[model samples]
Target: MNVLSHADSALSLLPPVVAILLAIFTRRVLLSLGVGILLGALLLTQFSLGDTSLFLVDTVKGLVWDDGALNSWNLQILGFLVMLGMITALITVSGASRAFAEWAKNRIRNKRDAKLMTVFLGCVVFIDDYFNSLVVGSISKPITDRYYISRAKLAYLLDSTAAPICVISPVSSWGAYIIALIGGILTAHGFTESGHLSVFVQMIPMNFYAIFAMLLLLCVAIWGLDVGPMRQHELKAQKGELFDESKGLPPGANADLPEADTGKIIGLFLPILALIAATLYFMISSGADVLAADGNAFSVLGAFENTEVSQSLFYGSIVGFIVTLGLAFAQKLSMELIIKGITAGARSMLPAIYILLFAWSIAGVIGQLETGKYMASLVTGAIPFALLPAVLFILAGITAFSTGTSWGTFGIMLPIAADMAMGSDSTMMLPMLSAVLAGAVFGDHCSPISDTTILSSTGASCHHIDHVITQLPYALIVALISIVGYVVLGYTASVMAGFMACCAVFAVSVVGLKYYAR
Candidate 1:
């Protein structure tokens, strides 16, 4: 029955939750993760209070020193930090971020344009969602704040806009990953075509939750529907008090450097170009699009699947960062000056990395327990045929929200969705799988505990809980509309219909709420 794994892993996350609560309440993300990790280890080991001396050693070894433990993901995450350091350094040394911000301010006259700019900025930095959060948060916080937007609201806008924007974008890190996963599904489904083109075309139209969530956020940004924590933010803005920043900048960051750097323009563009090139190359090398049902991974350059793309994009981002940093050094930028900018980026990410590490560890434990598979199996066994798609979407959404990871949730649910699809008509299967993935993202966007959500807050220098409180109401409102969209899509087996309905419903909801709530 795997009872020990289930008992230990399934419940191990509880202590971590308490730790996060303590961290938020105490204003310490790192300390929270440390305490949480220790507590999680204790739960896994069933250590008594008196046995802590030995338990401490073992837990440290297992968590930080073990081959697949914290240290490893720490290393992987370090690569990202280094990359972030280089890129942000490049931006500062050259002046691109400021220039972009200035251009945005000069042109963007309203909230809709601001939100659209955020989306466009997110699209422009697609190698990593983590990077996107930092750039967007650093740049947008000031702009949004000037317009009387709350830090929490800004954080929500940044967080919700980061990953999903990449996921849907044709040329981002997420694009490659989704492509890889879909490719495998396509092959298994006996498709004559390859590289996920078939599934991507079918599923993109059915990603209702993604479509509606963005629409709702954009609507709120423009028309202004203040409810839940948003209303509180509005009231605070009226009083001229906003976020609790440690400095004139966001909390826990340095603004000693001048706000404008003349050289930063070239610095910013270099690393971004490198990051993109590296990503495309990395995807090609992975087992992605190389094979055309004939056993090779590269029948064409454009054929790789999603996981392959994900791995490459992660690695590519690092490679791009190094080259970009080297360019700055070549241009006679002082090493000290460049290093300072790098440190700024890394310091900002410290909280996010801690949360990601714990989230990864939790994912490891849950994976050991096969939690998603079990849940999927349970749902599959209990539900009737007609209700499968809707039920699966709901289940996937809940799990992602609880765990604070849409990708992990999808990794689990995708296979189940594929299995269900393989058993049914291909027409019925593709859109349904997309719906589950979309819903998982919806839930992850709203989850207070999600790392992406947390990073977005950290990036925007907003109070974490404040971000959660404000964002949840908006996410839920969109999700409520999405439910109807998905059900109709499921029944009619029409991806286009579901997606358009989603847009229409969200538009109506945003207008009604803004008008009536007053």
Candidate 2:
């Protein structure tokens, strides 16, 4: 296989653009993504049929097996997804989901509290967005289901909170990755007076989209400020239509299964707790091992930077699955039923796995085309200093949206943002970097191909397209506010001012919408 690099041309935009537009209009995500992958391979192989076919085969094959070895990261993620599905299925079969829902029914008296519970859980699980996205959904879905909250809305809460919280938390995978990247960028540009950690801490307030999006989600949940497609979903939910089964359920949902009256809530709590504990333990231990190998002291933050997130999640899920099986057997579930549950669970995850596989394929194709690089190149020279942050925000958003990866957007745009700040106004560096983070998240929330977006929907048991459509209007609102905030910060070079401006605008918007609903 040849090492494919970026094409460095406008043609790089064609695949993702066509794929995104097709997904939006046709609502056939797999087909749309497949078309995009095909188009990219054609372009990459210069339309040679044999070469393009080989490239496509190699791309898919590399997902699990590459260079005579297992691709542990990708394989582990798939393993975790299946393990989570199995856990959820066993819980359902044991009637633990119903027991938990009944337990919550007594204390959670209203939809508002139910929605807030989801938000709270989302906030508490901040280690990794992949973990946060799925675990929180599985835990909260039953409570929200009892309250008639739409899966679409549940997914919104999950999606909005997952990345936003991860991006800001210093102990998280997102934080560690960003901190390390910022360290290199700082060194490259001769900004040595401040360390990357301090700079990252300072930029927290400057992350307008992430902060504002959290606030907006809270407002939406508390005030019933549903808008656009979400409003329709909510209305239907109130009428006992929580999910549109016509769109098909994401893998791992056993909502329609019968509940055993003898089951206990502990069945639900114990497995999930075990999963969380095991995951955190692996993350720390693995990271510590790396630090030891490099002769560095083991610190929590250092561990996070070196942690294998997918591998940790995979191992954690296996622990959780074992716990779940123990609980099921203790409940006196027959071997036949246990076997059925396991098979059903694995089968349920197949859809999510397929979508993830194709999504990864297209993302790889996008990388070969240098779509992000081409997009980043558009913002290179001669921008007004006052608009630099704003421009970076929009550019990062577009890149992430088109490429279907926020982290990739950060890799492509952050250094350029650093370079631009260095050349123009070095004092605006943190603000500019913050803007890139904000925009990448903004774009990620809106992109149909984004893995977190897919995971959110799967976790919530909502249709993928439904989650994408319902979340878009809300994401756009935050993006617009963030852009204005960045423009203000760029001109004034004041993180405080920009943050305040974003808060004020968001408050007014939420209040106005509440008033309008009345």
Candidate 3:
């Protein structure tokens, strides 16, 4: 492969920096991403207008079609996404989601119960962050609303669980992507003994941001500890003012189809169960050949290690879509209604799909420019290895924050982080990797331009900026704790001890913030 390269210079930072600034100022993610892509294309073409235009055309075309940059992997992901959209839409159109909501409403008598249910639902939909954000937000919003929970707080619950859960879950899209990145880096460097899945599992304990975020969410929900702007929002919501008049609301998704007369909760539960079962089955079956090649019959972890995650997800989602359609038909839905639901679901995913395409393209441009190398070069050996995890955490956090995409950050940073950890004491490698993953998630949680964040706000029917402002404090607190945890882990190199110490620190910090910081 003949890779394009550019000289390391200040110009290398233009695309991401421009994107970040535009996104923050305009609060228009799609525009920001498009500008970034255009800038990158210009730079890659050496400022030739003709070449940049042609590159843009080719890139846009390639994003959807198979012949260009949208290879098999990209297509598989797209398939999974579309299928998931169809499933979600079908469930909604079938009135299954409404039934589930009504059932929960009867059971959930108070705010605490409502919040707990929201968190629980968010955790349950761990297949993908996008799915988690949309489904949890849509299903839990009405229940939370009846209890006077602010849309901002609901958005927080949705956003907090999305990436944080996905990053740690062994079978999620995020996990699969991380595994692939790790596996590629390992193979590129000729290190074969350390399997990506094994390292990913090991790093789970060290992913302090994700762990702390979930814990903090539960604590906040259980105790009703609202601080910063969130406190104001919650108080106002309690006074029958769910939204601030000053802050304009973002448009929410409307399922215009009429609810079925005989809506049953089973309609929702069965499809979700089917999705989970299908995913596991496909994951295991797809890896069967690889496991046999290694003279192994089956082990749960081993099957996951050998699985073609994208392919498996694609197959699983297809099965899920089929099951959802079957259930809709069983409910005697008209053909027009079913088709409308499928199209509506896929339509809702279009914005996210556009963002992913642009994010990926800009990331490709960054690779060609060796942006990772340039960034890595700034970190010198004079910084003690003991502090490397902390340093890398900050760096990765900034990178992901600016890009508003954790997957892009992982693609750019994991390889460099892996190379940096090579030939060092093995204890340090997992921590460094964990730091990268944690930082990326932290950044994604905070970035207003983040697709997950945007989806969360939409899901909760909150103003976008309100969601960002209210959630920033909580995310920052957790991020600070994660940085401290990484620093401790760096010196201790003991996951157990480090986790205990970090938990102690979190306890003190959150308690103080709860009672005093407000």
Ranking 1 against 2 by lDDT, winner: 2
List, residue by residue over 247-330, the lDDT tens digit for candidate 1: 234432444554335554455556666776776676655545445444754533244343254356468778877876776666
Candidate 2 at residue 143, lDDT? 95
Candidate number that wins on lDDT, 2 or 3: 2
Per-candidate Cα lDDT values, in order, are 0.64, 0.90, 0.77
Q: Which candidate number maximizes lDDT?
A: 2
Please give, for residues 1-518, the per-residue lDDT of candidate 2 as tens digits: 44455557888899999999999999899999999999999988878888898999899998989889999989999999999988988888888888999999899999999999999999999999989988998899889999999999999999999999999998999999999999999998888889778889998988999998999999899989888889999999989988887776665577556556788999999999999999999999999999999999989999999888888999999999999999998999888878888888888888888888999999999998889989998996777889989999999999999999999999989999988888878888888899999999999999989999999988998888889999998899898889888888877788888888887788778887798666
Q: Give the TM-score of candidate 2.
A: 0.98
lDDT of 3 by residue, 1-518 (tens): 12245537657678878876786677676787788878878788888888778877766666566553457666786677677677777887788877877788778988999999999999988867766776577668667877899999999999999999999987776786788777787788776887778778878999999999999999889988788899999999999877775644343533355667666888877776776688778877777778998898776655665777668767877888888888888899989888888887787666556655666677666656665556656665688888888888888887676566788788877876777788566557778888999988888887755667776876676776678889988899898888888888888887776688779888997788778635
Off by over 4 Å in 1: 1-3, 7-43, 46-74, 82-105, 109-112, 138-148, 169-171, 189-195, 234-242, 246-252, 258-345, 381-384, 421-427, 500-504, 516-518
Model 3 stretches with alpha carbons more than 4 Å out: 1-7, 66-70, 125-131, 134-142, 145-152, 171-202, 227-252, 289-298, 334-340, 403-427, 448-470, 492-497, 516-518
* C-alpha RMSD in Å of predicted model 3 compared with the true structure: 4.1
Q: What TM value does model 1 have?
A: 0.79
Q: Pick the candidate with the highest TM-score.
A: 2
lDDT of 1: 0.64
